[model samples]
Target chain A: MRMPVVRTIIGVLSLVSVIVTVILGLFITPPDVVQGNLARLLYVHPPVAWVAYLAYGVTSLASGLYLWKPTRSMRWDQIAASSAEVGVVFTALTLVTGSIWGRPAWGVWWTWDARLTTTAILLVLYLGYLALRRVQVSREKRAKRSAIAALIAFIDVPIVHESVNWWRTLHQGATVASIGTNSKIHGIMAWTLLLGFIAFTLVYVWMVILRYEVTVTEDAIEALNISAWTLERENEIGSLSDEIAGLLSDNKDRTGTSSSKVR
Target chain B: MISESIAVAIKDLRVERRSKVGLNQVLPFSLVVVLLFGFSLNTQSRVLTTIAPGLFWVAITFSSLYLISRTMRLERENGALDGLFLLGISSVSIFIGKLLALLLTIFVLEVIQIAAVVILFSVHFESIALICISTILATVGIGTVGLIYGSLASDDRLGESLVPLLVLPILAPIIIAATNCWSDALGNHGGLGDPWLVLLTVFAIVFLTVGVSSFGAILED
Candidate 1:
C-alpha cells in the first residue's frame, strides 16, 4: 500500500524533472562557438557520465558493506543492482554521445586513443559483471560475487580518467575539470548543467528505492514458498514435522547469521 | 605446508606435462599472431625493429591470460580446488608457488618468442639481465592478480574469457610501468630508475598479499 503511493510520487516527480531538464538542455543552454549545435551534447554527456560514476561508486560502497556483512536485507543488493543498471545505461549513452562528439570534432567515429580504448574496456568489464550476475543461480551468491567484481571494476575508473596524462593518445585531456575554467561564458549554460545534475541525482535515488521495493517483494515470495514447503512436509510426516522445522530454522539462521545489513 | 603448495603446483604441472594441452593451444595461437604481424607489415628492418618490443610484450600479456585460465579451470572442474582447500596450507604459499610456476612457464615461452622475434626482425638486446628482471617483476604482478581473477572465475562458469575482462583494468599500471622500463632498457637509455623498479616491486607485493588473503573468502562456497 505504501509502495504504490511512494511510486506514484516518484513517477510524477521524475517525469516532471526530466521534462524540465530536457527543455532547458535543448533551448536554454547556449551553443558553443566551436561546436555549434553539436556542443549541446555537453549537457547530456557530462551529466550521464557523472551519474554513471555515481552509480558505480554506490555499487563499490554497497559491495564493501555486503562483504563486511552478508545479509538478506534487500537494500544492499538493491543499491548495487540499481546503481549498476543505471551505470550501464548511462555508460552506453556516454559512449554513443562521445562517438557523436568524435565524429564531428575529430572527423572520425572512433580513435584508439588510450582514453577511448580504456573507456570502452571499462564498459565491457561492467557488462561482463552484469552478465555474471544474470548467470549465477542464487541471490546470495550473486551479491557476493558481483560485489567482488564491483570492487575490482573500480580499478579502471581512475585509470580511464588518467589515461590521457599517462600515455600519448589521440583523445583530448581534461577540459571542464582542468585547472582554471576554459569557459568565459558561464551564465545560463552553467546553471542548466547544475540543474541537470540535480535532476539526474533525484532520478537515481528514486529509482534505487523503487528497485529495492521490487527486490523485497520478490524475496518475500521466495520466503513464503520455503515456509509453505516446510509446512506441507510437516503435515505429511505427522510427528517429525517439528524436528524438520527445527532443522530448517537452524539452517536459515546459519545462512542468515553471517551478514545481514542492507545499508 | 610448503610441501602442500608444491604438491598443488606439481599436480598442475604433471597434468600439463602429460596432456600438453595448454602448451599446444597457446603455442599455436602465439604463432598465428606472429604470422599475422609478419604478413601485415612491410619487410623493412627499421620498422620491424621499432615494433618488436611492443609486439613481444603484447604477446606475453595476451598468452599469459590463456595459460592462467587453463591452470585455474583445471582446478575448478575437477573439484581439486575444494580438495586443496581442505589441505589447510597458508594461502600465501599457494599464491607464491603458483606465481613461481606461472613465471617459469611464461619465461620459457617468452624466450622462444624473443628468439623468433630476433631472427625475424633483427632486433638486439644489450642487457639480458635487466630485461629478465623487468620481465620477472612484471610477470609477478600479472600472476598475482591473475591468480585472484582465476580463482574468482573458477567459482563461475565463464572460465578463461572472464579473466581478461576482470584483469585488464588492474593490469594497466604494471603494463605501463613495465613497458616503459623495457623500452628504456632496449633504447640504450639509462637503468630503469630505482624509483620505477621500487614501484613495480611494491605493486607486485601488495597484489600478492591481496591474492593470498582473499583466496579463502572466494573459495568459501
Candidate 2:
C-alpha cells in the first residue's frame, strides 16, 4: 500500500515540468522591455513567492490538524516542519531574486518598500520558527509550540499582502491584476511564468513529501534501534550475572568436596 | 479575578520599578533613535515635518516592543504565566490587565520619547489631546496584538526576531492612521478627520477581541 506507482508518476511529472519550465524560463520568455536581462529574475521571483504562499497554506492545514486531533502521531508534526522548511527556502529565494532584479530595476540591491520589507519579515519569521524547533528537546513540545507560532505567523500573511495598499510606500501594488494597466505581457512570457509557477509548486510539494517520509522513517528507525539495543542489554545482563553466580556455586561445591575428602 | 489581574500587573510594575530594566531599556533607545534622525536630516524642516509622524511612530513602535518583550519575559522566565493559568482566572481579564499595565508603560515611554523629539525637531503641538487620544487608540491596537504575539514568541528562543514579525504587519494600519493624524495635527490641517479615528478605533477593537480569544490557544501545550 506504499503507492509506488503514484509516487513514480508524480516524480516523472515533476521532472517533465521542471525541464519544460527551465527551457521556457531560459530562452522563450522575452526580457523586460525596460530592465532588459535583469527582469529575467522575475522568472524565478514570482514563482518563488507563489511557492512560499503555497507552503504557508500547508502550514495552516497542518496546524489546524494538530490542534483538532492532538495526537502523538508524527504525521502532522512532520508536515508542519517540512512545510516551514520549504517555505523558508522559497522566501529566501524570493528575497535573493528580488534583490537581483532590483539591482537593475531600482538601481539598488535593496529597497525599504512595503512589499520588500513585509516579505523580508515573513522570511525571518519562518526562519525563526525553524531555528526554534532545533532548540526544543521533545518533539511533541516543539510541534505544539511551533503550531501556535505558525498560526500567529499565518495571520501576518494577509497583513503583509495588504501593507502596500494600506500604507503609502515605495512598493508598487499588485503587478498582474492592477486595473487600467497596459503592460500587456506577451503570451510567451505569461505562459512561461505560469509554467514556472506550476513547476516550482510541484517541487515544493515533492520536497515536503520527501522530507515528511524521511522524518517518519527516521523516527521508526530510532524506535527500532532503541528496542534492539535494550533487548541486547537485557540479554547480556541476564546471562552474564547467571554465569558469574554459577561459577561461584560450582567453586563452593568443589570446596565442599575437598572439605569432605579432608575429613 | 480582577484582584488577581491587578496582582499580576502590580508584580510586573514592582519588579520593573525596582530594577528599572524596562524603563531604562526603552528611554535610551528611543532617544538615540530620535537623535539619529535629527543628525541625518540636519535642517530639512519640510522633510522633517513630512516624516515626523513616521519617525515618532517608529520610535513609539520600537520602544513598545522593548517594553512588551521585557514584561512577557519576566512572566515567562519565572513561569509566572503558568502559575497565573493554574489560578483559573479568565485569560481575557489577564490580557486586559496586562494590557492596561503595558499601555501605561508605553504611554510614559512615548511621552518622554516624543518630548525629546519635540525638543529636537521643534514640533508644534496644536492639539496635545488629539495626539494623546490618537496615540492611545493606536497603542491599544499595538499592545493587544503585541501581548498576544509577545507571549507567543516567548515560548520560542527567537524572541528578538519573532516579536517584530508578529508585530509590524499588524502595526501597519495603526501606524498609517496615527502618522496621518499626527502630521495633520502638526500642520494645522484640522484634526485627523474623524474617519481616521474611526478606523483606528475599529482596528483596536478587532485586535483586542482576537488577542483575548486566541490567547489561551497560544498558551496550550
The candidate maximizing DockQ is 1
> Clashes in model 1: which pairs?
A70-A259, A71-A259, A71-A260
CA-lDDT, candidates in order = 0.73, 0.76
**Clashing residue pairs found in predicted model 2:** none
lDDT by residue for model 2 (A2-87), tens? 74555566677778998998778777777778767666666678888889978988987787688676554557878888898989
Note the DockQ of each predicted structure.
Answer: 0.34, 0.21
lDDT per residue for candidate 1 within A91-201, as digits (tens), equals 787788899988989999888787676667667778777766665446776677777778766754564445433555776655556324656436777777667777777
**Per-residue lDDT of model 2, residues B76-122, tens digit only:** 77688778788886777677778878988888888887877777777
**By summed lDDT, which 10 consecutive residues of candidate 1 chain A come out lowest?**
A159-168
lDDT of 1 by residue, B47-164 (tens): 8787777777777788888878876777777687667667776666566667667766777778888788888888787666667777778788888778787877765665456778
True C-alpha contacts between chains kept, each model in order: 0.19, 0.17
